[model samples]
Target: MTFTGGNPQEEPPRRVAKKSKKRFLWLALVTLLALIAVVLSVLYDRGEFDGLRRRLLYTKAQKDENGCAQLYRYASDQSGSFASLDGSLVSVSMHQVSVLDETGKTVYEQTVKFQSPALVRGAFRAAAYDVGGTSVYVLTAKGLACQVDTSGEILAVALNKDGYLTVTSNESGCKAAVRVYDASGQPVFAYRSADRFIMTAALSDDSRTLAAVTMGQSSGVFTSYVVFYRINSESALTTTALTGSLIYDLIPMGSRFCAVMEEQLCFLDDSGEVRAAYSCGSDYLRRVDCGDGYAALLLGRYRNGTQHRLVTVDSDGQVMASLDVDGEVLSMSAAGRYIAVLFSDRMVIYDKTLAECARLDAVSEARQVLMRADGSAVLAGSTAASLYLP
Candidate 1:
């Protein structure tokens, strides 16, 4: 004798319908995100997505001795400092910092001056600290720093795409302190190194963590330590000893940090724990760039022979790609999820997945190289800056 309720017969179908609705909603959400991604990619190629342009034009041409049009009339003699800031070309002059738009229009200009109280230190000479935004920060040769507008006196600065700014200033007694600021330039957190000499530091993308490498010497032996701190808090999160090596650079990649040492390349999480590491036993670490969930290392050994290796790793610290490079690597730039290695006579571009994208032969020998995040590049030779968009 079973008594079935009126709605009991409809229960299974109702549950199935609810599950179908949830599945439909999830599919719709995913589809929307996919569409957005596709749109952004398209815009990125068009150069409109990031205030850039679809076409890249060099400066005006002047007739040279060989009757070849010289492009030097528009470029700069100062190629030591160059950066792409908010789709603009930023070059530093000994007297000022100039920003030029994609079409080659000067948008913003800041001049260095011999102001009071330090007239003997000379005017500001800028080398780009970090670009890729509307405004940049420049560190002068005389230990003076500015926010590239009117802000001043920053000893060091670290910024991420999330608009989190971590700036360090020189404190009393050979110490430095860090201050975390929001996008609007409001102070969100402050940290003092207290007694340690802050060597290299970076701010996590989420702005919730700060990683710094500091060193101390005792008994004529130096030991280095990598410390991680929670933002806006007095307590540190973790301290990891970089034993047996000296860290030369600290790079922040998303949520992790890369401690690039003399012969070791190590990745650490926000907790200061090593997740992945690569040690070049006989080779020397030349350069390391970590961004966009990828880390590219340039290792070379010139003592015994000319041996160079380009190694790329993922965020998980797994080696994604490795290649043997020839000759002296003049510079390496990591942007747009791609890595560009510039030799004197040639330059190669590799995509984020560690696949080769394009290789271009140097025309006049690459004195300086710059690349957009998407693999487009400007190779500045002695005469002109050749733009390559691939």
Candidate 2:
């Protein structure tokens, strides 16, 4: 009768109030921390801790004294699917193809608007190479190759020199062929194989040797054979098999060759003879460039990992130097005195001594790095491409 029990409703109200207060206090503390973070970020952006932040950012650009390298923003009008740099010129292709000079000015622009033959109705692939700084070799689909000047005019279609156009298509099961034409588009030599497929082909620098990878099949197993041939004429040549079992990459290293086959790094001579073979111990070899009497092999792990290794080897299969790198080495190009390595986020330029010359954040997703004959570097990225001059 005399209120032996407390007021239940009043006690419930006090408990609810205490919980609300605790939540409010927690939220207030979080808001204060966020405010402090914003303030710190603003200060950092305003150069309050610029030096410290730069160290953490690993910006080697500021340390470059000779300014032998620079970073430039390379934006393409279209999404770039392929990029190549030769000398101070950068070539990019996506919906169309264009060439940009060292000053970021368009030297040539051409829309790839050619219709393929009915027999070769597939997506076309293109590659551009600088012939002499004035002319470019444009290799396109259906064996349509052309040489264009810097002004975007066709100089020669279906080049007929000693080294002309050769195309290999897998349209027919394991049927491979090579068609050579003269500068006037006249067919000089044509060879077709009924047994195997020709995957790819490359000509030597001297234009006397022709290297190709041939695909062979037996009992559902796939194998590749590299054939080195003496290019006597477009029509008359002899090919000798070098190696078998899936040739992944073939690069002509001056008088010799370097290739990756089934995770093995192998070197071959001009006569299709194996010089040396070494286990790469990785899934794939990304790129190989020859310079300073050595080949720089960029090897990468297959899965998501940051471990990358750059190995330098002499022409005779001697290991010169090896360096562990941080990111995936995307592409590499070398010239007389420098080598430019393109990583995912950065571009490193090194001298013949393997000393770091300059490090720069890539303007975009770098797809290719080219060290020009003039000691400059060109970078081709996703959205843009740039040239770095010394």
Q: Please report the candidate that would top TM-score against the real structure.
A: 1
Tens-place lDDT per residue, model 1, 98-193, is: 555555556556664312111100012223432212234443322224453313344445665565566655555447666676665567776678
Model 2 over residues 216-262: C-alpha lDDT tens digits? 66566666666666666444243445444677556566666666565
Model 1's lDDT to the true fold?
A: 0.62
Model 1 stretches astray by more than 4 angstroms: 1-79, 113-155, 217-221, 304-306, 381-384
TM-score of 2: 0.61
Residue-level error in angstroms, candidate 2, position 227? 2.6
